[model samples]
Target: MGPVNKNTFDIGPALHRAILGAGGHDVAISDSMLASNGAASTREAKAFIADARDAGQTPLKASEVEQIHAMPDKAAAKLVALQIDLDPARSEMVAIAQIEGVWCRAMIDNVPLDARLPIYDFKTCENASPEACQKTILNYGYDVQAEHYRQVWQAATGEDRVFRFVFQEKTAPHEVCVIELGAGTLLIAGKKIARAREMWDKCMQANQWPGYPLGVKRVDPANWAIERWPKR
Candidate 1:
């Protein structure tokens, strides 16, 4: 439901035509294995498939398609087990708000209008285990994203809501992990957001954007980094 590759978008209807139905969308079996060359039905089917693309239709193939299809199974194993249905309109909920007079927007992955559930944001990655995700969380500043989404949601709905990240692996196995921030992490995130907001406000007021720091500063590597580097 989040921003997936372009192939995923058009593949849905194609699969529906090829396989009768895939991911609840119709993709007719497009592979013409039985219809011999120069056969009238084969020509018609090919024409129809093209027309479907032009008019929009489903038929599903390619090893790439297999990999893409595999993704839903893994994702569903987790989300379905948790009773989460990412139906359209419910997924990709856009929330916009004005924070400290600065406009902000959030494209939330899933928000159940009918039930009480923590807001869920999705991320595709190389690993979804807790340990792997912890490093990723910090490296990618997902904590900041969680805090930002929370702020935007609060501003729009006037309700304080919990946030969760649904991290799914991009490769084989496609493992998934659902994570929530602890109190300490949330506190840290709040501070980071505040600092960023202050910087944004200042930039807006001055109408001057900045690149890297103009001031000359010393650079030093951490002990761990120094130790990790190989000796030549």
Candidate 2:
């Protein structure tokens, strides 16, 4: 119900994005404001959950929630399998990968196994196309985000991995497009790490609040790009 332990590991494309944004730029909000905002969002989410229960939706029991919390390695298992196309027999044992020198505290599926691949992050829009997704990496400077995750994934899994972003429309599923790393994907992880380090250093000096600098990319301009990846 309450925000899970802050220390609980959650590393995906978005989380990496948040960390980069938080560490890099001087955010408008102060640390205290950010904490308060987190608390409010938690409360609102709980209220929404309670409302769902009142509406006769199957309410989540404490044990069910605990069970979900208890099994955190499923994501690792699923991502390694999905991204690498690694079947259990052809490759080394699938194990959960660690980032920030810590493994994720969430599961990919019901079965608990180590996930050895980095996941692509996609925020879908209703009208996204594959081409648009690719462009997002170029236009928005998400190259850094994808590169950082790739490095962490590779370190944990000993395999090359990529994280992608997708923005889609809420009303139209067909409008979704993905954002992926391009030429920069081949660069050493140290590059993004160093960039993040610089951004973080700047933030620390500026007394800035930390979070991802999420810029909403309008679908209007990406129409041409989306057309390039039109559904078959």
Candidate 3:
């Protein structure tokens, strides 16, 4: 569907992988647990790390620092703009957008739909440090949260979206920047929702969830839609 919807799907796993991959440890808690108990998991761990990093409590890792070098240059510049846009004084509730579902599970299916507004997602350079992000916008770690929320939003509402991955760079004590991913849209939401439904139906028909890795589950659109069906 749209950028917002597609991003929602990727946010969870992407954030999980980023933390473990960057920190060299598993920081995510099981989503299943979060729903059952009021306990923290990897998602909470990442948020805690982001806040702690911003506060300058935990030290930055060398690998994280090096990862900054790999981000696209343009994405870095856009991040600056995004930070400025969201930095103005406003109500805390309005400033902090509440992301919808994805609270039930960590895995997300790529779905595409159309939307009225384009949702922007920002990711920090591995080495950019927490201080650098605060100087610009909210911590880049929120990128995962943004994406995950968008996914649920798409499911609830069929709308297309543009997922922009703004990459930030650290220049000095009070300066940071961002760039956008070159990809047009992350995924089409309508297509994804249809796919998820198809798979769910198949699972019910066969009495088992189809075996596929994460987003790779094959769903036949013809089963759900009329006219042109997606060829698999």
For each candidate in turn, the TM-score is 0.70, 0.36, 0.30
Compose the digit string of candidate 3's lDDT tens values, residues 9-76.
12222332332223223233335434234343347545654554455333223333334333322333
Most TM-score-accurate candidate? 1
The numbered model that scores best in lDDT is 1
Cand. 1 TM to true fold: 0.70
Candidates arranged by TM-score, highest first: 1, 2, 3
Give Cα distance to truth, residue 129, candidate 3, Å: 21
Give the per-residue lDDT digits (tens) of candidate 1, residues 89-176.
Answer: 5666789999888788998777667545688777777888999888999998999999998898889988687888877776788788
Model 2: per-residue Cα lDDT at residue 227: 79
Q: Candidate 1 vs. truth: CA RMSD?
A: 7.6
Which tens-of-lDDT digit does each residue in 124-198 have in candidate 2? 233455666556555665666556555654666566644555354334122334344555454744576656657
Using lDDT as the yardstick, the better of models 1 and 2 is 1
Task: Please list the residue runs of candidate 3 whose C-alpha ends up more than 4 Å from where it truly belongs after superposition.
Answer: 1-59, 62-84, 87-117, 124-151, 154-162, 169-189, 204-207, 212-232
Residue 113 C-alpha lDDT in model 3 = 25
| lDDT of candidates 1 onward, in order | 0.70, 0.42, 0.37
